[model samples]
Target: MITAPLPLDEDLRLRSLKRLEILDSEPEEAFDRIARLAAWAFKVPIVLVSLVDEDRQWFKARHGLATCETPRSVSFCAHAVFSKRMLVVEDALDDERFLDNPLVLGAPHIRFYAGAPLLLADGQVAGTLCLIDTVPRSFDPHDAEVLAGYAQLVERELEVRSQLIRLQTAHERDRRSLAISEARFTTVFKETPVGNALVDLDGRFLDVNQAFCAIVGYSEDTLRTLTFAKVTHPDDLAEDLALVAELLAGKHTAYAMEKRYMRPDGTAIWVSLAVTLVRDAAGVPLHLIAAVQDIDSRKKSEKALRNYHVELEERVRERTAELRRSRDALQTITDNLPALIAVVDRDLRYRFNNEAFRRVFGTPSVALRGASIQDTLSPEVFESLQPLFARALAGERVTCNEVRYRADEERVWCTTYIPAEREGKVTGFYVMSHDVTEQRRTEQRLREKALIDPLTGLANRRALQEELGAILTHVGAVALFFIDLDGFKGINDRFGHDTGDALLREVARRLAATVRAGDMVSRLGGDEFVVVSRGVADAPGAERIAQALCHALARPFVAGGTIVEASASVGVVLRGTGDAARSVRMHDTLALADAAMYEAKRAGRNTWRLARHTAADKVKLNETRYPAEKAKSNAKKHSEF
Candidate 1:
């Protein structure tokens, strides 16, 4: 056996590996696809993109391994990382270095090994893309070339992932800075004294500052329902409409003229009004910013003196100065948000949109205003969403989840459509949307963590009980095997918990390998595990599974430089297919199975005992027939182990 040598630039290699920041990340489909493809190409049972950390080799993507990592001392990938070349060993038993290796002598029994070293962009070796098999095999030059190409794929993926992380970090920083700027601008808008209002191109009020509501003598809610035409005096309405038409036609950027407003109680007030057109980034008119001030006093006093006219003119100038601050603040707030905030009328035409809506639809927010949804969204998207929008406009508040395609990305969004109503009538809907893809992914990960055992990567007690409950609910025949490792406590005392944990992981792998493809194996916390086999036709089939589990657990486990032998005393129970038989509760079944497991220990170690419980007997469970203390009695009898 030839012991592997270290690389010449080991320090540089370690630094480069750490810099990628790919270790311990959630598995990605890109890397998993590479591993699966390699396994299929080589006709090997296992393939891994293994990274060599300081003390272990961690698998980023694994094709067949149950474990995600292993100590570096036993890692075959550790030897391959020494050079940027393909390393292949046809057989390990014949090699000097592996002749006495525990991996060669125990479970998984690796004989064939091949690896191609993966390198960073800086030309430092980080790890290897490796293939392994239990049987010895030979490879040719073509095979080596193909394997080397796979290494290049891994290197490119790592580089791309690192770049994406950097880009995301920079984007977050920019967003934070923009938020700060928007907040400062919002403060200025709130503090300004001028009567400023933002209205849709069609003249409906979208937002109004406090001063605007005061000057109009209407609450904000009331103003939202009334268009500029509704409040304008009949005599001045024609002139106001003509000026707005000129602005929309691009013949005028703004228009100012004195206008008469009719109050709620049949009174008329004269005001000086200046309206400016606001456009989005792409130079499309979006909103009309209107500044209004009460000039009735000035008009009435005009005949009294010229001094009053000068004083009123000076006040109007001061008000106009403050209006500029409000406009700047509104623009800043709308431009920074990624959320899609918009309003649409009963006619299905857009009334307003924030910056994100413009970016996604590939149209300026100002230009998109007053356009139909069918015109803004793709045909497929429009057809699917039209009904939801209609429901909102019909006075139904709606919230729904949707996935939409942006230029080159798919994003999950939670959208809420609120009905904008006035005087008990629905006028339009307010649409607000925000991305929820990352949040949903996080929730899924948390659910997986709860169900999967962190130590062995198998199902845990929670998963086992849930599966059993599901099987019972569906009324299926099941075989349950409760396995307790023999002498596991002694092994922990003698070898330490780390080795004990390693032994358990290896044992779990063996148990999983022994079961049929559809069987469920779970670790029920420390030294105990349960196997649930569904769709079993008879007790004999379950007995065969029990026998297989016993023989598999009797094998030796290699961990922490030690070859530890162990055995399992398994208790088996079979439930037949019938409503009555499946009606048994999960806890009672587990308790009966546990009682039977202790009986197996008494019968002797390294064997299985089947506990028989009929449908009628299960319905009549009590201390008299199958006493609850039977497990304790069995344990006390076999306490010498």
Candidate 2:
């Protein structure tokens, strides 16, 4: 077999493929859906989104194929990538390049192959979105265009994944930087010479540095129990209280003054104090951050020290405002996205949510924040999602399809959970969900169209094959009835095509009504119909069903104001015993039934014949004829069987 040579830009192409970070990753539904759709559209046995690596061609998404990868040397997709275009092989046996290929000679037996090369954003070929068939078939230009369109979809999904990875990398880098910044701030707070404390609006200390505890001459726990008012000198209390009130009232953001603190020994020490009020996003006061420096040694330098403290407080306020603006901007971007996005902490409480999430769940921002997941979602939904949440919290990235019924309408969602990890532990998880209701409905409709006969609304030929295959797996006796209407062509020739169609519909209805509830009825195109009945006890039981069906269609059908008389010529096959039954495949049974049908037609029509398998695995026919007297009496009214 001829192997494909590597492209001149092989190194660059490999680099681009690696940059996607998609090789050997778990299959994603988005990619799997594209592969399934391509297979369905092409009616091929296999479809794959193959990414060509240096040593192997890996399947990112595969349908109807069991293996995950194949060697790159004999890979058809590698050639497609190297050529940077679609490759089509109508018949591998006829093509010299693939005639000796292992895939063509062995399992899966590739005969017809078509691949559309997947191109990355950088113009490097990754691989192909390919279709494979065991039989040789011709592909027209339109088919190529369709394949190319599917390839484009794969490229787009790859691009989206690449962008998401890049974004996550940037986010992780930013988080590490923030952690470093916090670490530095913590070191400064604990080890700095100047005293620093975080105080609530009521003047109680929420937290204090070691320097603050030393300056106050009290332990950290002791300072937490005492309010600033209780520790301030009696002479300085009124002025300090006045300045705090003005800060709360927004008269000024920061205030600096000389204050005296009465220590445990009742000795007062003068200090320069700078206090700044910190507000939330809505400009509500949250806390007061204070910095104290000893001014007892040089009381004359109080003004200079106060000015320095005031400037420092102003810088702190500006930094706080800048961080808030950045946070608001990020929130805005997330809020406008179509996907419902949320972050849930380890406790299963919502730590963050986007506007889309709030709207979808019908919860307000204030109510949703810090709300338990169980409380935010309905009981049923919460229960259904609990396992997924647990898996994500256990550090598994999960993707699943969820269906919900709301107000009598079915809504489908595709959801993904990505764990947030810090220091080798899962701290939280991110939720992203997209509404896929329309897409799922469309797929359902397509499936229905494929299986149901549009004209008669009965199971079609394809459906019959699938059902028969399943029925043959069991050991029970099965009877297959192949019915052909006697003189359907004459009726069609005389009454016109429209009346013929109406008559066929009437026949289909009668056949369906004649069969048992467990039986299956199908129309196999062009005036032929089939019925499959399972659990039959013997050949007589099978004959009885065929007779009933023949009798049902023997009745006259009135269509388009024209009365048309038609009778059925049915060929029935009863599944045989022992080794013979095992050897009788679905098609073999169908052929036997079809041959018996012709026997009934030759036996004069309006009759049924049964075919059974012999020990030699050959079909033997048994004819069951109608009574001569009954045939004579109904000869003019109905055709003889």
Candidate 3:
């Protein structure tokens, strides 16, 4: 038998093949249809659009073939690439080169082959468009011509695909450059100190900066879901609408005003708004660019000065008409304030201090005029407050609450630091402190009373539901155990209420101790409780937790000298790492777990049962401890349970 010789232009042929860049790509419907058509036209069992690489013949499209490629040395397409025209073997059994070929002798058992070499524009053969038959057949001149026409169509499609790929590569490079430019512009838009918004001509928010979100007390995501008209103050909305109409009508290119924006919590804030119209190249109205400066504090200060002026006018009529004396009277009013107010420079030295501030620090205003906080406060206290000062200096308005011990009494003081800006640069900060010890203590006690269970000291049912709802919002695996104390009512009837309460407390302690630290146990009303655990992997992880909880509760309880004993029936629902796990709701999970608990009780109490809220198996009991003897013995025990 003779082997097929390689073409003299083999290196150039491989270069042309590599230039197509079609290897190892996902199959496209365009190429797949061509292969299917070729197989049907040639009346052959198999047809392949194969490309020969250095070591292998990779199929771009194949019909009726399980493998994607074969060794190049043994490939029928490899032999066909040696000729410019179609190659036909009437009978491979009679052909010297293919008589001992494994493809003709074993699997596929090709006895007839017809292939037209796929020639590129560079006049080099890349591979073939081949047809194969299990039985020997003869191909006439007409068949060869028809096959060659199909091969030309395949080559034309390959060239088009290569051009499309190159164009796509160039387009992707342009897209990436545009994205980088957009990202840099977006960073500046989001982080700028002045509030900025991109709004459509219809007054809908296209994008908003973080400063704008903070000013309106709405998140960036929430603002995008609303129109600017929705957040405008009701009294000011009509005027804002008129201004926008004028802008859209080409009456004004820009406008500025001091307007009010309504916050989410129903509070109004004043802002200095500067709006400019953006237009397309053809002068069509595109969007409105709005820049907002928060001016609430300035507005408040102006109002206060106006009131002081009115009072000064009344004083002039009632007492002296001297201007210098009116100023002295005004200073006296500020000095007598109950709240401690002071202004400190960037160096943390006092620029000005009110009489109230001096009294609180137990220093006279004349001596404390230019003193630093380090002079009055200990090193430890100064260090503790340094970070807050630093944050204020960084242009953040910060509020802090601190406890101060004065002799035998402790007082809580709320201090707010407002950064003072001069010409867009931070110069100093204003400080105000007021006592809020009683109010803070009352709030803390109220919060604890609302969240903690009165009896078990565990979290109540409300907190448990909240925790479960939070987990459902984020995607993760979670397992819930619904535990019901079995035969607790019998103990309450026989041993009395006091003994039952003791057993409940002990059970709560044991349940808390049985789970991981990240897990939460809650008392859901009477004898029912729930445990919500996160980071649990699959059904087996949940089953292990259920088994541990059963063992913890299976221990005996001694209460009120009656030696009360009770066990728990637990049902576990696991949200495994499956496709639909994240979409499951808290209530649905609870209902399924509750149903499984009843199944556990029906399965003769104290043994845990698993249920499918996920893709896992349903109604499965613990595998390690299914007792055939105990099942028969206690089959009728919990029939009423």
Candidate 4:
């Protein structure tokens, strides 16, 4: 009964085989181990974990065959996948499908055969778990059932392998997601460049980065043992700790403040501190994140600027004192002065003009006042004056000496310029004018004065009292000191007045330049001078200035072709706000200051005496000398003010 071969649905069969997802996989011991035992159990010559393909049966493991794949036209298992029921041939010569199949007749001659369909998970035929024997045999239903049970076991293993592949894929996805999240966390924590810390619930540091470690000046290991409180400066401790406690108690999620952090060496640094409490899923506090930014440098700059402002104020006070002196002298020497006095703005516009200006310009000083200089001066003068205005407006103080006017009949000499100031940007100017013609005439009359001393303008005495007063007001927070030149008479006699006068003038100028604004130097008489420094910083301040003066005057003073030198004894008296004990009274204080000066002279010729004000200062200063009670009732004045 040779007939045409059965036409297999090749595509569906291949898809069914692939759904197993087991093609070309390594021989798994779970399935292969089953094949080995089955080969032995059935006492068969061949056994296979075969996956059916479109036109072939491929073996995952073959017990009795060396070939891995066989052509389906000759394959015995191919027919099995097309049928769900087990196929058995009691004798191959009797079955048409197997009667001429080459595998049944070839090298591994299969005269008897039994194969059961391998069921898929989707309920379709996948392949077969089959056994083959060389000789024809009779079949029993029970034996067919028993071999079918082995096939089911192989199917179970295939299912498990599929499950493992899915589980492995899921695990990889989860791992990738976690890695991305951790990388983001690392980026956020490390790059901010501020001091940041992660601390446990008990406020112990778990981790901190390099910036935080540098700020606190502690190693990671050392900081781990200490809580945040240990690094807080004492002045800021109470407030910072209170915020910490509040956050821990759930009063707030975050707290921030400007604080000071103490370094390992116990120095404090200023920082703006911000802390946030991190919580767990249950809303219970778990850790704290602290961020600290150092502000010490910025704070120092501000303090330096403040100090600069104070120094600037002292300079203004000195200039104000000079102006007040000139104002006072105007009352004393009004008749002998030259020309007019006026104050103008940066534009050379008048602020005020004196009575002399009204007579000289002929126009009402008020009418010409607040008008530009171009109104009265020529174009050349106006152009020259522009640069002067620009300098003054730029905060420079300018002085013009001996300005000759083409408009005047006589060649005139005067000093005129503006005072410079500072604002946020632009500097405003204040104009001051002085007439020197009469003063120059007076100076010409005193030929003897010029010969005596350059500073004092005294015939015999050097310039003294005025320069002493000038120095006193310049250096604030100082003590006034007096000094006496000792053992000077003999030197003058031996050297002649020419050298003596030179020595005196040298001493005067040296002393004036050395001391701060608080101290003053005066020539009371020949070989005697007093030093006064008010608002002295300390006794040391006065002592240092005095020592400097002594060294300066000790240097050679050359006069009239002769070289000579002299030394002075010094006396000191303390004054001003920082002196808590009001020890010195006004008149009596000057007397004491004077007496101390004399005592230094008496002690020898070159020593200094510092007035002791502590005991008496506590007694006499019990009452406030200033801010006196007035006739107006205190309540009424308070209301008015």
Candidate 5:
């Protein structure tokens, strides 16, 4: 027997596969369900989602197989990966390459085989979605097409899982970065040379750093209980209070002045005081950041040289230099932050903005200041955000998500509006926006993948449950048809699973086509299907639907170039006359319909049974048959088969 040859890019391909970090991972339901559906579709006893490693082909998801992996030398999937396409072996025993392969000769005893290579986004073949059987069978082009479709589903699942892993990794990295940033801020605040303190709106000190405690000649604990007003000299108190009132009134964000502080000994020392109001995202004042620098020596020197113009000029230069240094430090911090932040006054003009705000809007800081919001933003974007801005101006905190285009690429931004209040009146608002495009896309992918049946492109059982619950809660009357395919097992046994899967897909299509536009049709796994019909007024209307479904299934289907016949055994349950439907549980209705389906099978195949709810809330079954002419036509078609 010949072993599969390695591709020219074997090392690169293996590296790409290992990068997914899925080689030896635990089984995921997302993958396992795909395997199960492929098994049911192909009517194969063994199906696997195989990932080819350096020395082995490992099964990430396996159905009808116990072993987790096999040596690459004996793996059929390895050959499929090497070929980078669908590989079909009608009879492994007759094929010279696999005739002596251990998997072909021993346990599992593979004869017929089909493998579809799984390709990643970068065009690297990781492994294969393979079907194995113990007996020889032919695989047609249609069979190959079905296998390819299932393979694509496996690829999508891999992409989604990989994307989730990457996203999680990014989240962890961001968390670490955030923790580091907070630590740096704490260090900077505590170790700065200037005296810094956090004061509340009521003039009470919330926190004071070491420099502040030294300047005030008070312990940090002793200062916490005292208000800034208590430490200020009485002569300077009125002016300081007026400046604070103006700060809170949103007339300015910050103010600076030479002020005198009274120490415990009643001695007054001059200080250069800078106060900035800190507001939350909602534009409400949270606290005040005060930086005080002891300037007693400078004040004394200024008094001694009051008549000297040169001395006065020198002092002015020194003070200006210190203020520039403080402004530069604050600017450095704001520019490093990733989020876009800006302050807008009540007239919708920009008052202040961070570096990120300028970068995102492509405007310089000088251009952005005092610019109207409407002029700074595109007409479309301004129109969309006008109401949110108005809401903030009206003292309402608002948050919304928006889709915007920049550099011809679409992005999602989460923006929050915080109203700044001055004496109970709104004076301005703060805007903070973050990009969330990737996050939104990931959530959307997860949602879509969860609700759809990858094999048939129909809604799965979960979607059916949700739809059923919604219908029962709102609709007056509804009918549920539980359909089980008749004589399906015989077709699978005769024509192989490939043919059986094709037939199942055809059945799903026919079932969908037989229902009304608003009717819901879903596959409940294997050969079972369900159709939900809303606004069915009576049993006759429900019966007509069931009959139509049975007749649709009764028609002969050509799968894998062979004529095959199958019929439907439908069990129907009709619920509600009006609001009474809300009282019926989804599970109870489904259970009754399932039981009635069994009764239809027991009565005879190719017919339907109606399950009616009695006054006692128990179910009573009534058998129904097709019209005589339709029954005769079905019989004649079966006879031809």
Candidate 6:
């Protein structure tokens, strides 16, 4: 170990060094061994692995040097990183840098010196490896190079330690984010079909679920004496402690990893843990709630799975020389997996394929191979991947989204394309997808059931969300005309649902004819059907159309020749981003239109209400008060308006 000279101002250097936070740290043996070896090899009395930070220099390891560190102003290593080369003082008395250095002239007298800079990942010269001696001596080059190697070792250790710290921090963040509840605790511990426990901060048992007691072959009373550590196998203690240490340090608040647990009967139970920290309102850590899924079944499953994986891997390795064999193996795996899989070439031609694709697309995997994607799948999906395919062909892997229409029905769902590569260049692509068609169908059916009226097929409240979501994306202006029929509930209660249904159906037919091209008329159920118009030239355009629908409906619908009065409350919400210069958030725009429709009902029944967007207009208005109030008022004035 070499003790380099502290500058003439010793006290000033120590002050600058304290803020680095690396001084007098826990014993990491790698550094301790290097410092010891350096001292003997160089025949010097002092060696230190010193780091330079914002204002201080700290020692991770030191030998022959009594104090932990010094200030940057009086340090040799601070100068070493700036030089961007080794700092070697064959004789401190002769060197100009040393003449003014305090250690050279004072107590820890320094004459010979050598140091190497430890570079951090960010290119900051974080610290240096240094050596020193009291007597003047010229060190050998081999010794200097070996010292440089030791410095590299320190740099590597710094990286490993830093990563560990980061991992601990992430773990702690997860712990802090997730909260605990007795309902969740009981559900997880008692009903989870696995062993579980609640332990205090010190690892003492507080509670164990029935499954845990049964698994350990111990009564609840019998398990109370033991702390968690007492039953943990020796082999599993290190990792268990490592995670716990991170938790204790507040570096991690929760932990989840696989490890075995020792049962009370001295048997080690293989398990997977998902544990979290419980805390009080003031954020003090209280206890740990852990779910121990008895991995014994999963372990048994894994054994079968591992055997299959090994067999699969071996077969693939044997055929690695041929791409076709490899593709075949891939197809085999995909066929058995629960998802649909397909492959496409640079031009979107089908390449290697899988069984799931065959099942869904109605073609054999081999038959589909080499066919164009557009020829096999819908044009919508093929066009969506056009850019992604182009990118993949240009040697880039792409994960792009697409939507495909179901050939069996008029429905669509999402898919993703993952480009495949070879030898540093993308060659083709792999498609792994799930059929979300059912999900979309479910949503549509639910919306229809909730929002659409059975008597009149019209857009319901649930349908409104989807409609607005779609309409807002159109940057072009839109006219939202909310039409509430003048009288319908009275017809239903008096004339029976049969005649009411017919009157509503005729009203729907007349309204549908009055709207222009690209306009939508949906029976919002009962007597309310909203007419949403796109490319509305102006408010007058909406007004003219609203008047036409009102006039068309006024003429007797003649359902059973009962020509009673039927009027409408037309509220037109003129929406879109205001002006060509400003981009209104389309989704928000649709919501505004929805609010304005209810407002039309609010103003009066049978007449229309209109609101146009302007730069001066506030987008966020009181929607809650208007929607419910409008629905109730409209129900009351069913025929009056």
Candidate number of the best TM-score: 5
Select the stronger candidate by lDDT from 3 and 4.
3
So what's the TM-score on candidate 5? Answer: 0.45
**Whole-model lDDT values for every prediction:** 0.77, 0.82, 0.76, 0.63, 0.80, 0.66
What does candidate 5's lDDT look like per residue over 1-641, in tens digits? 89999999999999889879998898899899999999999999999999999999999999999999999989888899998988999999899999999998898999999999999988999999999999999999999999999999999998997798889999999997767455434533554445778899999999887878888898899899999999999999999999999988878767889888999998988898878776554457777878787885445334222222222222222333443244443454345555677789989998877788666777876678899988887788888889999999998999887747264667788889999898989999988787779757864774676966766766789989998888777746678999988877778889999999888888888887777645778888877898987656567668878888988999899877888988989999998665555667888788778767766777787899888776555545653333236456545534433
Best model number under lDDT: 2
Error of 6 at 564 (Å): 64
C-alpha displacement of 197 in model 1, angstroms? 1.9
Across residues 1-641, which tens digit of lDDT does each residue of candidate 3 receive? 34456889888888888888888878977778888998998899999888888888998898988899988878777777776667799899998888989898888888989988988888898889899899998899999988888888898988897788789999999997767455435534554345878899778899997778988999989998889889989888888888888888868766778789999889999887867665543456777878777885445334333333333233322332232233333334446555666778998998767787666677876576688878866677678788999999999998887846243467777888999999999999988887778757864674676866778877888888888888877766678899988998788888889998888888998998887645789998888899987756566667867988998899888776667668989988887655577677676777667767877898889988887742443333443323346455344434453
Per-candidate TM equals 0.35, 0.44, 0.32, 0.37, 0.45, 0.36
**RMSD, each candidate, Å?**
27.2, 34.4, 23.1, 39.8, 31.3, 27.1
Which candidate model has the greater TM-score, 1 or 4?
A: 4
Candidate 5 Cα deviation (angstroms), residue 312: 29
lDDT value, candidate 4, whole model = 0.63
Candidate 3 wrong stretches, greater than 4 Å: 1-49, 58-68, 82-84, 89-100, 104-112, 120-126, 131-140, 153-188, 198-208, 213-274, 279-287, 292-641
TM-score of 2: 0.44
Error of 1 at 228 (Å): 4.0
TM-score of 4: 0.37
Candidate 3 residue-wise lDDT at 293: 71
Worst 10 residues of 1 by lDDT: 304-313
- Pairs that collide in candidate 5 are 42-497, 282-418, 282-419
Tens-digit per-residue lDDT, 191-239, candidate 1: 2334667789889988886767777788889999989899899999999
Across 1-641, the per-residue lDDT of candidate 6 in tens digits comes to 23343335434434433423345577689888989987887778998898765456778898988787777667778778666578888887787766768888885898878999886665556668899888888767887789889888887887777677668888987664443232223333443335667788788888887767866667777667777777777898888878987876767556778887777667887777766665444446667766565665665334333333333333333333342344443455566654567777767787777787666777888888789877875787667667766776776555532355465665354555666777876768777666666656764686657755455555555666576667665455567776766556777777777777788888877776666423566765556677776655466556766667667776766775676667666666666444541355544454454565556556655566665554654454432433446466545655443
**Residue pairs that clash (backbone atoms under 3 angstroms), model 3:** none
Query: Of 4 and 5, which scores higher on TM-score?
Result: 5
